[model samples]
Target: MGGSKKLIVCGGLFLTLILSIGATAPKGIRLGKASYRKVTISWQAPDAMTQVAHYKIYRDGTELGSTASLNYTDETVQPGTKYTYKILAVIVGGGNSEFSSELPVRTLKSASFENNQLVEKVVDSFHDTPKSDLNAVSLISAIKAGFEALLGSNISFSVIDENIVTSVVVEELNWINTVTPELTETERLAVQSEIDAMMDSSFAGNSFDHMYINQKLTQLGDEHWGAGNRTAAELFYEFSLNYLSNHESTVSCSLARLAYFAKSHLTQDSSCADISESLSKAKACSERFFDFFPNSAPTSTYAKSALSQPAAWYFSYFPKMLEYSNYDALFFSTAYETAKRLVAFDPADKNAVQRLKRVAAWELVTLQLRFVDEKGNARTGSVKICNVSAENGKRDLFHGDAYVDEREFTLSNGTATVPVYAGHDYSISLNVDVANGNKLKFELPLFKYEKNKLVSYDYLTNSFTETPSSQSRTDFVISSTAYPYNLRADRGIDVFDLSWDWVAPPSFTTAGFKVFRGNMEVATVNKQTVRLPLNNSANEYRYKVVAVDANGNLSSTSQILTVYPGDQSQYSDFFEWMNRYFGDSDIYAGDDPDNDGVDNYHEFLNGTDPTKVPGPTPYAGPRGFYELTLEWDAVSNVEGATYQISRNGTVVGTSSTTKFTDVNLVPGVSYIYKVKQLTPAAAATDWGLPNTFTTQKAHNYEHADKVQ
Candidate 1:
């Protein structure tokens, strides 16, 4: 009588087939077939309604079957059995009409259920030795149709696919989950049509297999963001046209030959000989274009007439690898001119259309190749890139080399804005002038079509990093840069103090040096100092620097610097030395390589060994506006010693002198404080008495001075 807008839930899974809508009665209830072991119930939807979502069938009084279209067949009936059927029309606006008058039906005494018995037989015979070739899918569909015709909806059945049963339910779940969200209404309709075709008995056997492959091909296109209803034939047509777009008769003819060969694998192999021979002869004509399309020849020749009918040969084609690499102009005024003449004579010529699309997609297939420094700022350069071989499922094209480096393009402002076809593979490399002879450098592999159109080659590493998911994310330094000056381990920032600094010789001419971590150039530091972020505290890293001149020449590297917890101060002499190279080091100074509470500078100034911590108290100076400073009391005059001060157990500042100013405090809140001194040996002095202080409280809300 009534229905609510509910999620289509059937049995245990979600069903989307029926859109049960408003109440409106269907007319002309009738029994189409009544026989033993089978019964068919039918009804007529009113002609007034423009859309009928489905018909919900009810048996006796229980709702059971739901069919998207008219008619239903019930095969579960026993011989000589009688049954009653009623139908409710489900409409698009989430409404269900009243049930139609019941149709009384009976099973005949002699009706045999051959499909049902065949399913049972297949299930019983399935095994691993020969993986059951029996058509269980069709048999299941027939059985489902029979049951759904009467009482079952959301009908799905599976048998042992092999010795190991394939879980069809899981496959269905994945299918629904992967596609439902992205499926447009049109796409859904197309998918449904494919599904309907699959269950259609007319498309049985190999024809059905071909349909399934084409459906998946459409899905592949969808996955890659291709739009519209595209058929396999259309894809092949576009592919072939891309070849003929060269406007060369031999090029077109060569591709035509390939297509003819390819079609044999797609359809009946024996029937494709004429097409294959014709393409061969066409290639021969292209080679002899001067003789065949002579300037003296009449325009109304038999050859010209046949050339107008291009559709017959223009479905798909590919030039041989040698032809692709030749790079010479072809099929122009000679053979290609003849093809165009045919096209002008016949616009609907399938050959002409296919050829033009190939030309069109040529523009579509190519994407920009960008080159930039690790920072991704565009730079100019003559970069060479090799493309991985794309056999297009036919490796015979690339005989000797599996991959070729034929693709080479220069950068305009660090980007080659040229388009390349899909499935092209890229390998980046460039020669550098070094102490030795020029070495062939390489970059990471960038697969075309698999990656976005704008691919990047980093300047520092000469490699490709990750394919950035967004344009903004590519701004970060994923690669490294070279830096100059002897890198000395220095104090890090903040309390956790996981950061480490690389201090180099300061110079006004220092444009910036590249800072490298392993093979990666992490950053180009304009200043003489750089700090590692605390996030990398867990990972070990090798540090080296090469200063860059104003002219951008990198000087000789100073030496490799190593850091591990508990070894920050072991290399202070090497770090402190100018124009010096330090090879071996267990630690460095003025840094918290040990990750303990205090820094090396504080330990040095507090008359404590830079290697030990909790040694001396730090003295505090007068606090200033918006700044709090703490200094290590001059208990020891260790060279390059510094002080660390904290407010209520939180580190606030570091100073080289015995006195330090503390700034930026709340006006009213009282805070307890502590201080520590550090030295060149990466030592720290801790355990200073907690001194409590209260700042002047603010009374006026409007004054900006009170906020700081």
Candidate 2:
């Protein structure tokens, strides 16, 4: 009986759910190609709809001009916005069906065949260079090719996208533009002109050939669909290998790539391909570059180049051997023998021997860095890295300018090389005061770096992985030019009303802003703007902002700005109040001791007591129209008190009630008002506040609504 009752309850609940849903969601909803700033969505009518009056379309939850058909043409969207669309079936009887399935789309930038070939030319040039002289341009160009090859038909600025490629490009451009000490106005303008021209024509005209893009998309689809047969490490390693390999690696390390692929493939199905011969070929090839040590004086730059540049490039694929199931042990035994040979060739080759051991152990060591922003967009600047003392409790790794001069390094192209010490802990720090001036430092674990590897921190997922961990820096500028503004004090207590529009920090690790008046930090504010208390006699103020990253890493930026003190807002009235009530040096306009949102300076401007909370209501309704009528939310809690209203500092009227009328004020002019509550004892009614309203010009009688 209980089981029957439960089944009945379940059946009733399912029926209720079906009734509430009302209609089935549309099937076969599809998004068309969205490459040129337009998208189309189509779907079949839901099977549940009956007597459908018309179909309604919605974009981004808002109607983008509804349609009565089953499809939508959205032409108003840009490349930057990803739009989602859905359809609903509205009936003649005023009821509506459940919304159809949603389809989201975003336009992708395309490049022409010639542009693609040109990109290949750049990559070829980069790949042909010797590793020592092969700057970021070579590596980045190669990586760019890899991106075009491996990136699926997806639009995102993720770690897996082309952010690393563009970051290098931006770094190179910045290096060209920013003069080490400073850039003059003329030089800056010249660089800016060049950049504008390049943006207008150089990159904008490029688009991928449709067939080629389709081929890549198809390839990506195949790989993704078949990825379940492999391990996550193997899949990720394959992606890394495909993205990092250029023509040179393709030609020379063909067996290496194939053997690695086969090794992983054989784990699932051994009957597919014979990889034993390919694996042997790869081991023999790896031995060719295993003997030379770049750190030692092996006069043969040829041999060093073979090992560190082209050869090291090839051997870097050695990690995939470990990622394989069977080939790892097989490859490690051979690599260990190669290490023994290096020690035999040079009895003093301790480093080479250790590297061999690392090769066998699969240890990670920092080889290169690609600095980027919090969004995984590459950054172009110098970063300070330090080797923290294993003993010192201070961990003073990156508080302020420690080893800035000694360990300072800028990315080449968008990369920098650091010596790999197998077991040493390191820290990278920078000042990132873009939002609120701050400094941060990130401590790195030695365990994270694999031998001859790169940082691959994914900004999209906010995750870190060794070997291709996309490195990033906080987006911030500490100089004067960060969204500058004019500084004008209220003259009563030398408190300047600061309204500076500054750049927001790109990272989430910032603590607050530290305001410096010349040499000393005058105040700290976490927000963009704060009332800065200036010296009574000083005529100008200079401020800088710094940003702090999550790992306490700090990024310092240029671009400074300065604002001079202008005429006081209330030069006459405020000074008089301050001087008459207390010494001019004691009470400051910015000081709000009572924790009211209204500052003491604004209080003096309105002749209200600053010591009390809710002191003489601060700024009431500053809203409403031409020949404007203004109103306020009345102050209660006071007993039998009347109110005094003032317009433009002149006593206009007094009412026993909380209402007033100011007639015929000139249009297009500004007016200020204040209200004070009056007690029956005739004491200072000390309630109410100041507000401002400006009248608009009279409208022509063209439109009946009369709204501007």
Local accuracy of candidate 2 as per-residue lDDT tens digits, 1-708:
332222111111111111111012224566533433455666776566477778787888987766667766666665335677777888869889888666655443322221333333333333223223534444444444443443333223232223433443445435433533343333433653665466446333222222223223223323433544222222233232222122223222332433344344333223212333444444454333332222334543333333333223223444344332324454445445655555555556566655555454432333666655545544454556665534333222222232221276666555566543344345655423233533322323222345534445532233455433343222222232232222223333475554433344444455555555655666666665567655535554665544434465434432233556566664667767766656655567666765667786687865666665542443433334434444554555656766677787788777666556566677667888777766564334454556777776556677834564
Q: What is the lDDT of residue 656 in candidate 1?
A: 73
Off-target runs (Cα >4 Å) in candidate 2 are 1-297, 302-315, 324-327, 336-657, 661-664, 668-674, 678-708
lDDT of 1 by residue, 143-219 (tens): 34443433335444321111111233334434544543544333434654675466453432112222332233223
The clash count for each model shown is: 67, 50
TM-score for candidate 2, please give it: 0.25
Best by lDDT: 2
Task: Give TM-scores for every candidate, taking all chains together and pairing residue i with residue i.
Answer: 0.22, 0.25
* Per-residue error (Å), model 2, residue 632: 5.5
